[model samples]
Target chain A: MAIESIDQTSSHLKLSNPDSTTLVIHLTDDWRTTSHLAAFENVCQGLETMPSLNKVLFDASGLTGWDSKLLTFVLKVRGWCDDRKVDLALEGLPGGVQRLLHLALAVPERQGARKDAERQPFFPRVGEKALQVYASAGEMLAFLGSACVAFGQLLKGKASFRRSDLMLFVQESGVQAFGIVSLVSILVGLIFAFIGAIQLKTFGAQIYVADLVGIAMVRVMGAVMAGIIMAGRTGANYAAQLGTMQVNEEIDALQTLGISPMEFLVLPRMMALILMMPLLCVYADIMGILGGLIVGVTMLDLNPVVYLNETKASFNMTNLWIGLIYSAMFGVIIALSGCLRGIQCGRSASAVGDATTSAVVTGIVSIIIATAILTVIFSILNV
Target chain B: MNEAEPQIVVKDLDMGYGSFILIRNLNFIVNKGDIFIIMGGSGCGKSTLLKLLVGLKEPLSGQVFYDGTSFWEAGPEEQKRIMRRFGILYQSGALWSSMTLAENVAIPLEQYTSMTRAEIQDLVSLKLALVGLAGFEDFYPSEISGGMRKRAGLARAMALDPDILFFDEPSAGLDPVSARLLDDLILELRDSLGTTFVVVTHELGSIFAIGNNSVYLDVQTRTMTASGDPNRLLAESKDPTVRAFLTRGAEGK
Candidate 1:
């Protein structure tokens, strides 16, 4: 028997045949993970060149150092040999590499464990998304029903939630949020006055800036700005808090203790928002008018007294009532969406984040939809 | 028994959250290749002690030394160099919910190593396969079982081939079979890799199964009541609290 060296093409690897039925892989040089090593395909190519290969042996006498990269290459070779029922000798490898290989292969993979990345066809994906949307709608409806039941219980004074929690939620969603609401409402009013003055001044109808800002602020802009602010701020907070509680199994704890999470958690938040929205809307209206007055006096060159008089004369009770109604509806929509998303959140950190984002989106979308419906109704009723 | 060099030494460690001391004057030594258990009754600050050991929280007053270098006293770069050698498996697995299992395991390797993307992928598969999660590379943390998630966490922790691994309540939510398997895996890893383990758990099964050395924190006294081999402590310790805990309160009765 003659051992003849065959391939010394790659510096890190060599191939030889001791017998026609056996192939010996000669590993050389540093095979550290950070260092470049011969590709697994080189070994495979060597195996292919030998037709009657029944055994694979390693000659690592030339190998200076090795790490996981060497082991990975060996494993790939082992897998290839296993598929062909060929003998693979590990005795020539380092002791540490042998031990790691043994440990890695000790446990057989569970059947059907791997989730293959199967991209569904377009129609199936669309159908799956539709099904998910349907399921979500069902969950939202059920949550809304539960909320209604909790409100009913409250009317009968039988709801089982702490008064302190209610008070705390009221303080959070109301008093703590005033600064942001005021700032946004005033800015909205000022922008409205500036745009109106620009257009009205072209026709020398600058005094009509007071009419435009006054009517728009009282009719819709004030309530809409406040609603958007609360949706992003308080609505997201509600979702995050409840989603975390859900993650920690606090909701389950309440259920185990014969407490309704609806009453204990959702009721307080809803009540607080509903109670505060109209008040916040009214404050926003005043602030918006004040902002418009600033523009009217400085930008429009109108007297402050005349601008205030014009605003008062332009504003009617109908517009004020409509704005309050919009805020009240927005409060319900925001609180419901936030609470619903939170309660329906999956038990994971990222799920809480997704819940917060969904809460804000759902709140804002529902508010706009509600405003559109209410505006159409008020117009038809000639209010 | 031959005394191996101390891998971690805690001296006069005081741990608490502002004015309320949970455990004070805690001292212990974890030898190289030892599976050191931190055990106590509920609310005894076992997790907090694990936090201190892993550099998550600073000790109120004392020192944590790893291989003779003080952890808290080390410069930021020095501390990071030390921390890079540690692998911590938090309770509940704590896998990033947004990432698939493969991504979670590959992050540390990608951050710390100059390995190519293919090498990183191969290592990720190897690590995952080591923990019996070979084929579950694409699954997210939320998609797996609790036990599987823990194993994935273990795989990610082992990504850097850390010298020391810390586990917080490794068997907290596992079934009996799963918990036993986890215990076996820990023992096998320690035996094969000679990786030191610091585990916080009150599970009597685990404490007796894998622990070669242990420390018991007493909630009532707010201090470490016992330290040494758990089996030996069960036999020879004179403290009633230690006896009661090891016997699951049967000795007190």
Candidate 2:
């Protein structure tokens, strides 16, 4: 090889003499979109002509497009040069391209051109940040809308609801929850009656414990407490079950086969809890009233007939309906938060655990907030 | 027939996980009825290359061709139509754990074809029969052996009678006997259907047995070393790495 004319294609790589200690190769072809192997072979073939070369420069000036194939070619050439102790310099690459090459090739270099250029922050880049905001809000809103739609469409699928899944959710959310709800509601009612007894005794009206417990249980406390407990238990269960399935690629497999995972997984759980929670809340109310009755009979020396009569007189239909509405709202929030966490879970077993914890936390927080808001509204409306 | 009419052609493919390049400039073609194997060392982007071929991931750059038509050039409906002509058997079989064997086989049939329940069941049974699992329709994936699950995956892959099938490491975790059995099944499929296959594997037994043509990836260089009939390459290649890899197992024997 002898001296040849040196030509400048661009600032990146200038074609120089083959005999010179330095040679530059510029890959300004459709190597990424064209036949990748042929494009790669072209570079290899072009470089093979140089028998003696100490240093070489690579310019990606006209490399309008590139891909993994082209990257592999560059890496291959780098290896070849390395084997022969040739120092290859790269220039005029885009920052993104330079970053990718550095990461892929595991090589780092800096030049004056790239130093002063301001690049966007990795986290706050408009694309992913916008998606994060949109995704979080969208995921929350999406569960509400999609869960409702999927609930209606569940029965239309080829796999009819296995009576087992329904029975399982019921047994878990209803039968298992009964003892806890009853115990808590009774304690709450007794606490209310004890306080009312002490206050009413000051005015010689201690028998009003019957009125206090009856109104409170039927109006708010019974439903709100039951809803909160269910939010912790059933909502967390839904998230853990579906989140595990999602991480294991079961949800993706369903989508590929045109089965909506929402319909397959979430709708049944949501519908079962929604249909069951209010009834459970009503049961809690009855148990709470019994606790109040015990307190009134023991503490205030009120007779059973008189206590029952005061309870019946004080319990209004509007109060009962208020409890029902609040329980229903709590059910929706629990189901929504659970399903959202489940579907949005990351692809790992640990993520399933995280989703379960998140579901419980979100479910409990939302229920408490919702109960407080509804209680205020009910008081303002005198319901 | 035009010699250029490949069943699938990948041109200048670049795929990565957002700034980390996995495979770059991967170009290869599978002619009609050809058994093309992509071989590389572990983590040399074989699986990523398979994903790009099947449209699971968008390449950072480059194009894939099926029958001379650009894959990305097609509309969604057209891409779906093209998808119907091919099938995929993922590394782990990727079968639906919740579904029974019969239901798994019926997925593509039920989704792409307008077959009634009876017709779908019949087709599912036929596919299962072809994969030597005619009587195991009611068994869930967990209840079956690994070999049986791979067979079921194959049955599902072939449900629509696709002209092309792609498998990502068909014998990865199998016992030698089971892997050999699967390899025999692959040969049987190729012989009977004349379907084009694109497999990504470094299994020498499979490469020697069924690979009509192959591409070898050099891990150190991160590019293709050689591509041709493996037997010929084994006999005539001048590349040191290619020779070393191909002969390493032989040296052990």
Of the true interface contacts, what fraction does each candidate have? Answer: 0.00, 0.12
Ten-residue segment with the worst summed lDDT in candidate 2 chain A?
A5-14
- C-alpha lDDT values of all predictions: 0.88, 0.78
**DockQ for the candidates, in order:** 0.02, 0.13
Chain A, candidate 2, TM-score of 0.63
**lDDT (10s digit) by residue, model 1, range A1-383:** 68787764488888888899998888888988888777788668778888888999988998999988898899999999999999999999888889999999986774545898899999999999999999989988899999999999999998867676789889998999899988988888899999999899999998888889889988898889889999999999999988987785445434422347798789999999999999899999999988998999988899999998989899999999999999988999999999999988998999999999999999999988888999899999998
CAPRI docking class of candidate 2: incorrect
Q: Model 1, B1-253: lDDT tens per residue? A: 2579899999999989877677899888999999999998887899889878887678889999999999999996677788788888878676655469998787677657899989999999999998889999999888999889988988988888889999999999888988898899899888888899999998998999999999999877889989999999999999998999999989942
Query: Which parts of model 2 have CA positions greater than 4 angstroms off?
Result: A1-211, A297-309, A372-383, B1-12, B30-34, B52-56, B61-88, B98-140, B144-147, B159-164, B194-196, B213-253
Q: Name the candidate that leads on TM-score.
A: 2
lDDT of 2 by residue, B71-144 (tens): 88888666766776877887767787767999888877766788898999998999898878989999999899
* Candidate 1 lDDT for residue A42: 68
Instruction: In angstroms, give how far residue A300 of model 2 lies from its true place.
Output: 4.7
* lDDT assessment of candidate 2: 0.78
The TM-score values for the models, in the order shown, are 0.63, 0.66
